[model samples]
Target chain A: MTSLLNALPGAVSQGLIWGIMAIGVYITFRVLDIADLTVDGSLATGGATCIMLIRAGLNPWVALLIAFAVGMIAGFVTGILHTKCGIPAILAGILTQLSLYSINLRIMESKANQPVSVDKYPLLVSSRHVGGFTLKNPIFLMIIIAIVLITVLYWFFGTEKGCSIRATGANSNMARAQGINTNSNKILGLMLSNGLVAVSGALLAQYQGSADVNMGRGAIVIGLAAVIIGEVIFGKIFKQFWLTLLAVVIGAVIYYVVLQLVLMMGLNTNDLKMLTAVIVAIFLAIPFWKNKIAGKRLGKKEASKDA
Target chain B: MLELINVNKTFNVGTANEKKALDNLSLTLNDEDFVTVIGGNGAGKSTMLNAIAGTFRIDSGSIILDGMNITSLPEHKRAAFLGRVFQDPQMGTAPSMMIEENMALAARRGQRRGLSWGISEAERTQYYELLKSFDLGLEDRMTTKVGILSGGQRQALTLLMATIKKPKFLLLDEHTAALDPKTAAKVLALSEEIVTREKLTTLMITHNMKDAIRYGNRLVMMDEGRIVLDISGEAKKKLTVAELLAKFSEASGHDETSDKMLLS
Candidate 1:
C-alpha cells in the first residue's frame, strides 16, 4: 500500500500525457467518424523525430514542433490514399502505419531504441520531477496544455469552416449539397488529429527519457480506452464540448490509476496487453448491448399491447 | 436558365447487370420556368435530375447553367447554383446538427466559409422569424437536432433550406413522397407557395400525375430513358390526369400497363 501510494503521482503524470494523445484519437473517432490506425505509427514517429532533433542540438520546443509537422505529413499521405486513390480509410491508415515502421527505424539511425538523458538535455517534462511542486512538474504542465488545447479546439469548432467539417462527418451528402468540399475537410481533420498525437508523443519521450521504435505499438487501443472510459463516466453530465474533452483526460488518469492497482494485484507484466484489449472490448460492447436489450423490451411491450 | 445536351449515363457497365440509366437525354429550361417531370419507374426521371445536379459524371454530355459549361464541375462545385431535395427526408439535412446550424449551413451555400463564427445573432433572429412563418412550431426548437423531428417537419425544413440561399435552380425529387397524405398535401402547398413567391426555376419529379398537371408552368413525361411527351402554355394548363395518361400511351407507343403510375 505504501509503495502504491508513492507510485500514484507517477501514474497520474503519465496518464495526463497519454490523455493528450487520446484527445487526438477522439478527433478522428468521434468528430470525423473514422477509426484511424495511423496513431500507432505516428506516435512513434513523433517520439523518434523529437529525440533525434534534440540529439542533433536543436531546441526541444522546436524539435517538438517539427515532430508535429512530420505527423501531419504522415496523416496527409493517409488522407490522399483514402480520398484521391479511392482506398478505404481503414486500409489507408494500415498502409501508412506499415510504412511508418521502417521510416521510424530509419529516423533512429537503424536503432530500435534511443535515449535522451534528462541529465544532459532540457525537456518539457520529466519523470524525475514526477512528485515535485516545482515548475518542472509534468502534471501541472500537462494540465495547462490540456486546458489550452481544449479552449483552442472549442473556439475552432464554432467557426464556419469547422462547422463544415462537422457537417461532413455527420453527413457527407448534405455537406456536399450545401457546397462544402468534404474531401478537403477530411484531409484537414486527419492532419489536425495526427499533429496533436505527435505533440503528445514528443512529451511522452521527454518524460521517459527515451524513445523506442515499438513504443507506440497498440497506441490506438489505449486512446480508444481513454475516449470510451471518458464517455461512459462523464457523457451524461458533460454536454458542452470543452467539458467533454476534459472528461477524456480525467478518464486517462483513472485508467492509469486502475492499471496500477492491477499491477499491485500481481498480474504478470506480459499479460497487460491482453487485459487492455479485454477491458476495451467490454467497454465498447456496453452501448450495443444496452440498445439491443431496450429494443427487445420494446418489442415485447408492443406484442403485449397487440394481444 | 439550364440546358442538358445529349446526356447519357450507364450504371454497371460491361457487366451482366449493365443498365443504361440515362439515354441521350436533352432538356432546356428558360428563366423562371417551373417544370414538373412525371414518369414510371426506370424512365430516367430521377436520372435526369441527378445529371443536372452533377450527382455523377454523365458518360458523355454537356450541361450549361447560366451561360457557363458545367458538365465537368464536381457536385460540390455545382451546388453553388443548385438546391436539391431528395425523396428521402433523411437525405437533405444533417440529422445530428442543430436546426439552426443546418439553416446556417444552407444560408451560406456557395459562399466562402472561413474562420468567422458559424451562426450570428442576427442570422439566428432571422431564422427564427422564417421558421415561425411555417407555423410548425420549429422556431422555439432552434437548437434541437433535426434527427428528432418528424418526417413532415423535415420535408418542410428542407423546402426552406432549398430556397434559403435563393438558388439559381431548385431540384425536388419526390420531396414529399415519404409523408402521410395530409402532411404531403401541406408540404406540396408550401412548395407551391415558395416557388411562386421566389419565381424559382425548378425541376420537380413526381409519381403523382395530378400533381404534375396541377403545378409548374411546364410538364415533361419520360419513358424508356427518353422524353416521350412535353406540354406547355395552353396545352399544359387545360390538361387533366386522364388526358395525360392517354397522351402518354399514344406518345410512348405502348399501352399503359403500370398501375402504380395511374394510381399514384
Candidate 2:
C-alpha cells in the first residue's frame, strides 16, 4: 500500500502524457470514424525526431514542433494511400506503421534505445520532478498543455473547415452532395490526429529520460482504452465537445492509477497486455449486449400485447 | 441550362451480369424547364439524372451546364451548381448533425470553407425565419439532431437544404417515394412551391404515373435506357395517365405496362 501511494505521482504524470495520445486517437476513431493504426509507429517517430533533434543541439521546444510536423507527414502518407490509392483506412494505417518501424530505426541511427538524460538536456517535463511542488512538476505542465490543446480543439471544431470534416465523417455522400471534398477532409483529419499523437510521444520520451523503439508498441490499444474508459465513465456527463476531450484525458489518468494498483498486487508485467485486451474487448461489447437485452424485452412486450 | 450529349454508362462491364444502365442518352433542359421524368424499373430515369449530377463518370459524353463543359468535373465540383435529393430520406442529410448545422453546410455549397465560425448570427436568424415558414415547427428545434426526426420531417428539411443556396439545377430522384401518402403529398407541394419561387431548372424522377402527369411544365418518358416520349406546354398539361400509358406502349412496342408503374 505504501509503495502504491508513493507511486501515485509518477503514475498520474505518465497517465496525463498518454492521455494526450488518447485525444489523437479520439479524433480519428470517434470524430473521423476511422480505426487508424498509425499511432503505434507515429508515436515512436515523434519521440525519435524529438530526441534526435535535441541531441543535435536544437532547442527542446523547437524539437517538439519538428516532431509534430514529421508526425503529420507520416499521417499524410497514410492519407494518400487510403484516399488517393483506394486502400482501406485500416490497411493504410498498418502500412504506414509497418514502414515507420524502419524509419524510426534510421532516425535513431540504428539504435534500439536512445537516452536523453535530464541532467545533460533541458527537457520540458520529467518524471524526476513528478513529486516536485514547483511548476516544473510534470503533472502541472501536462495539465497546462492539456488545457491549451482542449481550448484550441474546441475552437477549431466550430469552424467551417472543421464542420466539413465532421460532415465527411458523418455521411460522405451528403458531404459530397454539399460540395465538400470528403477525400481531402479525411486526409486533413488523419494528419491532425497523427500530429497530436506524435506530440504526446515527444513528451513521453522527455518524461521517461529515454526513447525506446518499442515505447509505442500496442499504443493504439492503450489509446482506445483511454477513449473507451473516458466515454464509459463520463459519456453522460460530458455532452459538450471540450468536456468529452477532458474525459478522455482523465480516463488515461485513471487507467494508469488502476494499472499501478494492479502491479502492486503482484501481477506480472507480461500479463498486463492480455488484461488490457480483455478489458477493452468487454467495454467494446457492452453497447451490443445492452441493445440485445433491450430488444429481447421489447419482443416480450410485443408478444404480451398480441396475446 | 443543362445538356447531356451522347451519354453512356455500363455496370459490371465484361462480366456475366453486365448491364447497360445508360445508352447514348441525350437530354437538354432549358432555363427553368421544371421537367419531370417517369419510367418503369430498369428504365434509365435515375441514371440520366445521376449522369447530369456527375455521381459517376459517363462512359462517353459531353455535359454542358451554364455554358461550361463539366463532363470531366468531379462530383463535388459539379455539386456547386446542383442540388440533389435522394430517394432514401437518410441519404440527403447528415443524421448526426444539428438542423441548423446541416443548413449551414448547404448555404456554403459553392464557397470556400475556412476557419470562420460555421454558422453566423445573421445566418441563424435567416434560417430561423426560413424554418418558421415551413410550418413544421422546426424553428424551435434548430439544435436537434436530424437523426431523431421522422421520415417526413427529414424530407422537408432536405428540400430546404437543396434550395438553401438557390442552386442552378435541382435534381429530385424519387425523393418522396419513401414517405407516407399524406407526408408525400405535403413534400410534393413544398417542392412545387420552392421550384416555382426559385425558378430552378429541375429534373425530377418519379415512379408514379399520376405525379408525372400532375407536376411540371414538361414530361419525359424513358424505356430501355432511351427517352421514348417527350411532351410539353399545353400538350403535357392536357395529358392523362391513360394517354401516357397508350403512348408508352406505342413508343416501346410493348402491350403490357409493369404492375409497379400501373399501380403507382
Candidate 3:
C-alpha cells in the first residue's frame, strides 16, 4: 500500500505528459472531425529529432523547439496530401505515417533505441530540491508540462486563427462560405495536434530514459480515451474553451491512475489492451446512453398522459 | 448586382447518366432585386444558385458579382459576395457550434482571419441584436449549440448567419422546406423581413407554388433548365398561385408534375 501511494505521484507525472498527447488527439479526432493516424510517426519524429539534435551538442530547449518545427512540417505534408491531392484524410494520415516511419529510422541513423548516458548527458537533467527530494521527480516534471501545455493551448485556441480552426470543425462548408480558407485551418489543426503529440513523445522518451521504435504504438487510442473521458467527466464545467483543455489534462491523469488501479487489482499486462478498448467504448457511449434514457423517460411520460 | 452570362453546367458529361443541370442559363439581378425561383424537380432551380455561388465550375459561362468576373473564383472566394442558406437546415451552420460563434464566422466574411479569440463580447452583442430580427428567441440563447435547436430555429439562425455581414447577394434554396408549416411560415416571414431590411439582392428557390407567388419582387419559373416564366414589378404583385401554375403550363407546353413534388 505504501509503495503504491509512493508511485502515485510519478505515475501522475507520466500521465500528464501523455495527457498533452491526448489533447492533441482530441483536437484532430473530435474538434476537427478528422481520423488522423499521423500521430504515431510524428510523435517519434519529435522524440528522435530532439534526441538527435541534443546529441549533436544543441541546447535542450533549442532541440525541443526544433522538434516542434519538425513535427509541424510532418503534419503539414499530411495536410497537403489530404487537401490538395484530394486524398481521404485518414488515408492521407496513413500515408504520412508510413512515410514518416522510414524518415524516423533515418533520423535515428544507427538503431531504434538510443539511451543517453545517465552519467554523461541525460536530457532534462536532475537536481536536488530544498526538500531534499530529487527535482527529477516525475510529479514536478509533469506539473511543469501540464501547465505549459494548458496555458499555451488555451491562448492559441482563443485567437482569430483559433476561431477559424473551430469554424472549420463545426462545418467545412460554412468555413468556406465565410472565406475562412478551410484548407489552411485543416493544415494548421493537424500541425498543432501533431506538434503537441511530438512534444509529449519527446518528454516520454526522455522520462523513460530512451526512445524506442514502438513507443508510440496505441498512442492515438490512449489520447482519444483521455479526451473522451475528460469531456464526459467535466461536462459543462469545462464548457469554457480554456477549461475544456484543462479537463483533458485531468482526464489523462485519471486514465493512468485507473490503469494503475487495474494493475494493483492483479490484472495481467495481457488484459491492458482489452481494458483500453473497454474504457474507450464506455466513455464514447455516454452521449448515446443519455439520449436513450431521455427517450425512454419521454416515452413513458407520453404513455402515462395518454392513459 | 450579379450577372450570369450563358452559364452551362453538365453533370457526368459524355456519359449515359449525363445531364445538363444548367443549360445556357443567363440571369441578371439588379441591386436589391429579390428574385423568387420555382420549378418542378430537376428544373435546375438549385443548380442556378450553386453555379452563382461557385459550388461547381460551369463548363462555359461568366458569373459577375458586384462588377467582378467571379466565374473562375473558387467557392470560398465567391462566398465573400454571396450568402447562401441551404435547403437542409444542417448545411449552412455548424450544428455543434454556438449561435454566436456561427454568426461571428459569417461576420468575418471578406476579412482576413487572424489569431484571436473566437467571439468577443462586442461581436456577441452585435450577433444578438442581429438575431433579434429573427424573433425566434435565439438572440437570447447565443451560447447554445445550434444542434439543440429545432430545425426552424437552426434555419432562421442560418439565415441570420448568411446575412450577418449584409452580403451582396443572398441565396435561399428552399431554406424553410424542412420545417413544420407554422415554423416554416415563421421562418419565411423572418426571411422576408431580413431581405427587405438589408435590401440584399436575393434569390430564393421554393417548392411551394403559393410561397413562390407571395415572396420576392421578381418571380422566375424554371422549366427544363430554362426560365420559362419571368414576372416582376407591379405585375408580379398581382399574381396568384393559380396564375403562376398557368404560366408554367404555358411556358413548357407540358403537364405540370406540380402535384408530385410541390410543397404546401
Candidate 4:
C-alpha cells in the first residue's frame, strides 16, 4: 500500500501525458468513426522527429511543431490511400504504420533508441520535475495542454466546417445530401487526429528522456483503452463534446492509477499487454451487454402488460 | 428548370448481376412543376432521381440544371441545386445531431461552409418557427437528437430540410413509404402544403397510386427504364387507378401481372 501510494504521483503524471494521446484517439474512434492504426507509428515518428531536431540544435518548441507537421504527413498518406486509392481505412492506416517503422528508424539514425538528457537540453516537461510545483512539472503541463486542446476542439466542432466533419462521421449519405464534402472532411479529421497524437509522442519522449523505436508499440490499444474507460465511467454525465474529451483524459488517469495498483501487486511487467487487451475487450463489450439486457427487460415488461 | 438528357446507368456492368438501372432516360422539369412519378419495381424511377442528384456518374448523358451542365458534378457539388429525401427515414438527416443543428445544416446547403458558428440564435428561432409549421410539436424539442424521434417526426423534419434552403428542385424517393399509413398521409399532406406554399419544383416517386393520382400538376409512369405515360393538368386530375392500369397495359403491350404498383 505504501509503495503504491509512493508511486501514485508518477502514475498520475504518466496518465496525464498519455491522456493527450487518448484524446486524439477519441477524434478518430468516436468523432470520425474510424479505427486508425497510424498512431502506433506516428507517435514514434513524433518522438524521433523531436529528438533528432533537438539533437540538430533546434529549439524544442520548433522541433515539436516539425514533429506535428511530419505526423500530419503520415496521416495524409493514409488519407490518400483510403480516399483516392479506395483502400479500406483500416488497411490504409496499417500501411502507413508499417512504412513509418522504417521512417522512424531512419529518423533515429539507425539506432533502436536515442536519449535526450534533461541536463543537456531544456524540455517542456520531464519526470525529474514530477513532484515539483514548478511549471516544468509534467502533470501541470499536460493538464494545461489537455485543457487548451479541449477548448480548441470544442470551438472547432461548433463551427460550420467542424459540423460538416461531424455530419460526415454521423452519416456520410446525409453529409453529401447537405452539400458537405465528406471525403475532404474525413481526410482533415485524420490529419488533425494524427497531429495531436504526434504532439503527445513529443511530450512522452521528453518525459521518458528518450525516443525509442518501440516506445509506440501497441499505442493504439492504450488509446482505445483510455477512450473506452472515459466513456464508460463519465459518458453518462459528460454529454457535451468538450466534457466528453475531459472525461477521456480523466479515464486515462483512472486507467493508470489502476494499472499501478496491479503492478504493485507483483504482476510481471511482460504480461502488461495481455492484461491491457483483456481490459479493453471487456470494456468494449459492456455497452453491448447492457443494451441487450435492457432490451430483454423492455420486451418482458411489454409482454406482461399485454397479458 | 432541370433537364436529364438520355442518361444511362448500369449497375454491375459486366457481371452476371448486371442490370441497366437507367436506360437512355430523359426528363425535363419546367419552373415550379410538381411531377409525381409512378412505376413498378425495377422501373428505374429512383434511378432517374439519383441520376439527376448525381449519386453516380451516368454512363452517357448530360444533366443540365438552370443552363449549367451538371452531369459530371459530384454528388455533394450538385447538392447546391438539389434537395433530396430518401426512402429510409434515417438517411436524410444525421441522427446524432440536434434538431436545430440538422436544420442549420440544411439551411446552409450548397453554401460555402467556413468557420462560422454551426447554429446561431437567430437560426434557432427560424427553425422553431419552421418546425412549428409542421405542427408535430418538434419546436419544443429543438435540442433533442433526431435518433429519438419517431418515423413520422423524422419524415416531417426531412421534408422541412429538403425545402429549407429553397433548392432549385426537390427529389423525394418514396420518402414516406416507411411510415405508418396515418403518418404517411400526414407527411404527404404536409409535403403537398409545403410544395404549394413554396411554389417549388418537385419530383416525387411513390408506390401509392392514390397519392400519385391525388397530388402533383403532372404524372409520369415509368416502365423498363423509360417514360411510358405522361399526364398533366386536367388529364392527370381526371385519371383513375383502373384507367392508369389500363394505360400501363396498353403502353407496355402486355397484361399487368404484377400487383406491386396497382396494389399500393
Candidate 5:
C-alpha cells in the first residue's frame, strides 16, 4: 500500500502524457469517424525527433514544435494515400505507420533507443519532479497544457472550417453538396490529430528520460481505451465539448491509477497489454449490449400490448 | 441558365452488368425555368441530375452554367452554383449538427470557409426568423441536433437549407418520396413556396404525376436515357395524368407503365 501510494504521482504524470495522445485519437476516431493508426508511428517519431534534436543542442520547446510538424507530415502522407490514391483509411494509416518505423530508426541514427538525461538537457517535464508540488512537476505542466489544448480545440471546432470538418465526418455527401471539399478537410483533420499525438510523444520522452522506438507500440488501442473509458464514465456529465476533452484527460489519469493498483496487487507486467485490451473490449461492448437489451424490452412491451 | 450538350455515361463498361446510365442526353434550362421531370425506373431521370451536378465525369459532354463550362468540375466545385436535395430525408443535412449550424453551412455554400466563427449572433437571429417561417416550431429548437427531427421536419429543413443561399440552379431528386402523405404534401408546398419566392430555376424529379403537373412551369418526360416529352404553358396546364400516360405510351412505343407512378 505504501509502495502504491509512492507510485501514484508518477502514474498520474504518465497518464497525463498519454491523455494528450488520447485527445489526438478522439479527433480522428470520434470527430472524423476514421480509426487512424498513424499515432503508433507518429508518437515514436515525435519522441525520437525531440530527443535527437535536444541531444544536438536545440531548445527543448523548439524540438517539440519540430516534432509536431514532422508528425503532421506523417499524417499528411497517410491522408494523401487515402484521399488521392483511394486507399482505405485504415490501410493508409498502416502504410504510413510501417514507413514511420524505418523513419523513426533513421531519426535516432539507426539506434533503437536514445536517452536524454534531465541533468544534461533542459527538458520540459521529468518524472524526477513527479512528486513535487512546484511548477517544475510534470503534473502541473500537463494540467496546464491540457487546459490550453482543450480550450483551443473547443474554439477551433466551433469555427467555420472546423464545422465543415465535422460535417464531412458526419455526412460527406451533405458536406460536398454544401461546397465543402471533404478530402481536404479530411487531410487537415488527420494532420491536426497526428500533430497532437506527436506533442504527447515528445512530452513522454522528456518525462521518461529516454526515447524508444517501441514506446508507442499499440498506442491506438490505448488511445481508444482512454476515449471509451472517458465516454463511458463522464459522457453524461460532460455534455459540453471542452468538458468532454477534459474527461478524456481525466480518464487517462484514472486508467493509470487503476493500473497502479492492479500492479500493487501482484499482476504481472507481461499480462498488462492483454488486460487493457480486455477492459477496452468490455467497455466498447457495453453500449451495444445496452441497445440490444433495450430493444428486447421494447419488443416485449409491444407484444404485451397486442395480447 | 444551364445546358448539357451530348452528355454520355456508361457504368461497368466491360462486365455482364454493363448498363448505359446516360446516352447522348442533352438539356437546356432558361433562367427561373421551374422544370419538373418524370420517368419510369431506368429512364435516367436521376442520372441526368447527377450528370449536371458532376457526381461523376461524363463520357462526352459539355455542361455550361451561366456562361461557364463546368463539365470537368468535381461535385464539390459544382456545388458552388447548385443546390441539391436527395430522396432520402437524411441526405441533405448533417444529422449530428445543430439546426442552426446546418443552416450556417448552407448559407456559406459558395463562399470560402475560413477561421471565422461558424455562427454569428446576427446570423442566429436571421436563422431564427427563417426557421420560424417554416411554421414547424423549429425556431424553438435551433440548437437541437437534426437527427432528432422527424422525416417531415428534416425534409422541410433540407428545402430551407438548399435555398438559404440562392443557387444558380436547384435540383430536387424525388425529395418528398420518403415522407408520409400529409407530411409529403406539407414539404412539397414548402418547396413550391421557396422556389416561387426565390424565383429560382429548378429541376424536380417526381414519381407523382399530380405534383409534376401542378408545381412547375414546364414538364419533361424521359425514357431510356432520352427526353420523350416536353410540354409547357397552356398545353402542360391542361394535360391530365391519363393524357400523360397516353403520351408516354405513344412516345416510348410501349404499353408498360410503372404501377407505382400510376398509383402515386
Candidate 6:
C-alpha cells in the first residue's frame, strides 16, 4: 500500500497524457457531433510517426509537430470519405481506422511490439529544471502541453469560426441558413480534434519509450470516459471553454486517483478493463438515477395521500 | 427585391417518379414587398421559396435578388443576403446555446468567420436591445440555454436572429405551424412586428388561410407547379379567405374542398 502511494505520481502522469487524447475526443464527440472511430488507429499513427522520426534522429519537438500534421492529413482523408463520397460519418471513420492500421505498420516498419529502449532514446525522459522539482516526466510535459493546448482551444472556441463549428453540431441547417458552410466546418473540426489526439499519442509513445500498433485500442472509450466524467463533475463550475478543459484535466487526474486507489485496495491488475467499464457506467448512470429516485419519491408521496 | 425568371425545377427528371416541383415559374417581389404564399400539398409554394433560397439546383432558371444573378450560387453562398426560418422550430436556433449566442451567430452571418472573439461590448448591448424588443423578457434570460425555453420563445428568438442584420430577403417556411395555438399567435405577432419594422422583402408560406391574408402586402396562390393567382395592393386589401378560395377554383378549375388548401 505504501509503495503504491509512492508511485501515485507515475499513474497520474500517465493519466495526464491520456487526458490530452480525451480532450481531442471531446472536440469530435461534443463539438463536431462526429463519433470518430479513427482515434484508435490514428493514435498509433502518431506514436509510430514520432518514434520513427525520433529514431531517425529528429528532435522530439519537431517530430511532435510533424506527427500533428500527419494526423491532420489522416483526418482530412476521413473528412473526404465522409463528405465527398457521401459515406456515413461513423463508417468513414471506421474505414480510416482500418486503413491506418497498415499505414501505422508501414510507418514503424518494425516487427510488432518492439519497445524503444529508454536508454537509447534521444530526448530527456524526466523533466527537471534547475528552478523546479523533478516530477516523473510526463506530468511536467502534460502540464506545459495542457496549458498551451487548453489556452489555444479556449481562445479558438470563442472565435467566429469556432462558434460556427459548434453551431454546425447544434443544428446544421441553421448554420446553413446563416451562411455557415457546415460541411467545411465539420471537416475543420475533425482535423483539429484528431490532430490533438495524435499529439497525445506522440507524447505517449515518448513517455512510455515505445510505440505499439494496437496501443490505441479502446482509446475513444477512455477519451469519452474522461469527457463524460468531467462534464458531470465540473460542468457546472466550468460552464465554458477554458474551465471545461481544466475540468477535463482534473477528470483525468480523478480517473487516475480512483484507479490507483482501487489498486491499493488490492484489486487485481487484470481487472483494469472491467474497472474502467464499471467506473464509466457509474458516472454515466447519474442522470438515470436522479430521474428514477425522484420518480420513486413522487410515487411514495402520491400513495400516502391515496391511503 | 427578388426576381425569378422562367425558373424550372424538376424532381427525378426523366425518371419514373418524375414530378415537376417548379415549372418555368416567373415571380417578382418589388422593393420591400411582403409576400405571403399559399398552396395545397405539392403545389410548388415551398419549391419556389427553396429555389430562391438556393436549397436545390433548379433545372433552369434565372434567380435575381436585389439585381444580382444568383441562379448558380449554392445555399450557403446565397445565405449572405438571405435570412430563413423553417417549418420545424428546431431548424432556426441552437437549443443548447444561449439566446445571445444564437443572436451573435446570426449577427455575424455572411461575414468572414474567423478565430477571434467576435462579440464585443457594443454587440452585447445591441443584442440585449434586440432581445428586449421581442417583449418576451428574453433579454433577462440572455444566458439561458434556448432548449429550456418553450417552443414559442425559441421561435421568437429565431425570428429575432433571422432579422438581426436585416438581410436583403427573408424566407419563412411555415415558421409557426409547429407551435401550440397560443404560442403560435405570440410568435406570429412577433414575426409580423419584425417584418413590418424592417419593411424587408419577404416570402412567407403558411398553411393557415386566415394568416395568409392577415399579413403581407401581396398574396400568391399556387397549383401543381405554377402560380395560378397573385394579388396585391387594393386587390389584396379587399380579398377575404372565401373570395381567395373562389378565385383559386376559377383559376385551377377545382373546388377549394378538392385539395388540402381549404382543410387548413
Model 3 error, position A293 (Å):
7.0
Cα error, residue B262 of model 4, in Å, equals 5.7
Cα deviation in Å at residue A303, candidate 3?
A: 9.5
Candidate 2 structure quality by residue, lDDT tens digits, B1-264: 788888889989999998898888888899999999987788888888888878898899799987899999999988898999999999989988899999999999988999999999999999999999989889999999999999999989999999999999999999999999999999999999999999998899988888998899999999889888899999999998888888888888876556344426
In model 3, which residue pairs have backbone atoms overlapping below 3 Å?
A: A158-B116, A158-B117, A159-B116, A159-B117, A160-B115, A160-B116, A161-B114, A161-B115
lDDT of 2 by residue, A96-186 (tens): 9999999999999999899998888899999999877898899998999999999999889889999999899888999999999999999
Candidate 6 C-alpha lDDT tens digits along A134-218: 6545567678878899999988988888889889998888888888998888888888878988988888888777889988887
Which tens-of-lDDT digit does each residue in B1-264 have in candidate 4?
888888888999889999998888888899999999998888899989988888888899899988989889899988888889899999988999999989999889999999989999999988888788778999999999999999889888988998999988989999989999999999999999989999989999999888899999999999888998999999899999888888888887666766434436
TM-score, cand. 5:
0.97
Model 6, span B186-229: residue lDDT tens: 88888888888898788999988789888999999888889898
lDDT of 4 by residue, A221-291 (tens): 99999999899888889999999999988988998999999988889999999999999999889889999
**Could you give the TM-score of chain B for each candidate, in order?**
0.97, 0.97, 0.94, 0.97, 0.97, 0.94
Order the numbered candidates by DockQ, best leading.
Answer: 5, 4, 2, 1, 3, 6
Clashing pairs in 2: none
True contacts kept of 4: 0.83
Chain A TM-score for each candidate, in the given order? 0.98, 0.98, 0.90, 0.95, 0.97, 0.88
Better of 2 and 5 by DockQ: 5
Classified by CAPRI criteria, candidate 4 counts as high
The residue-by-residue lDDT of candidate 3 on A1-307, one tens digit each, is: 8867866766677678888898888889877999899998888888888877777778777887888888889889989999999999999998999888888888888588776544455577322111236776656767776788788877877777787788799889878888878887899999988988888887777766667766777787788888888888896677887688888888898988888887988999888978898878887787899999999999999999999
Clashes per prediction? 0, 0, 8, 0, 0, 1
Give per-residue CA lDDT, model 5, range B1-264, as digits (tens): 899898888888899988888878888999999999998888899999999988888889799988889999989988988999999999998998999999999999989999899999999999999888789989999999999999989989988899999998999999999999999999899889989989999999999998999989999998888898999888999999888888888888876455345424
lDDT of 1 by residue, A1-307 (tens): 9999889989999899999899889888888898899999999999999999999989999999999999999889888998999999989999999999999999999999999998888888999999778988888899999999999998888899989988988888889999999899988898888888888888899999999899889999999999989999999999787888898989888889989999999999899999999999999999899999999999999999999
DockQ of each candidate, alpha-carbon based:
0.86, 0.87, 0.75, 0.88, 0.89, 0.73
Candidate scoring better on DockQ of 3 and 4: 4
* Candidate 2 chain B lDDT trough over 10 residues, lowest sum: B255-264
Model 2's DockQ score = 0.87
In angstroms, how far off is B85's CA in candidate 1?
1.0
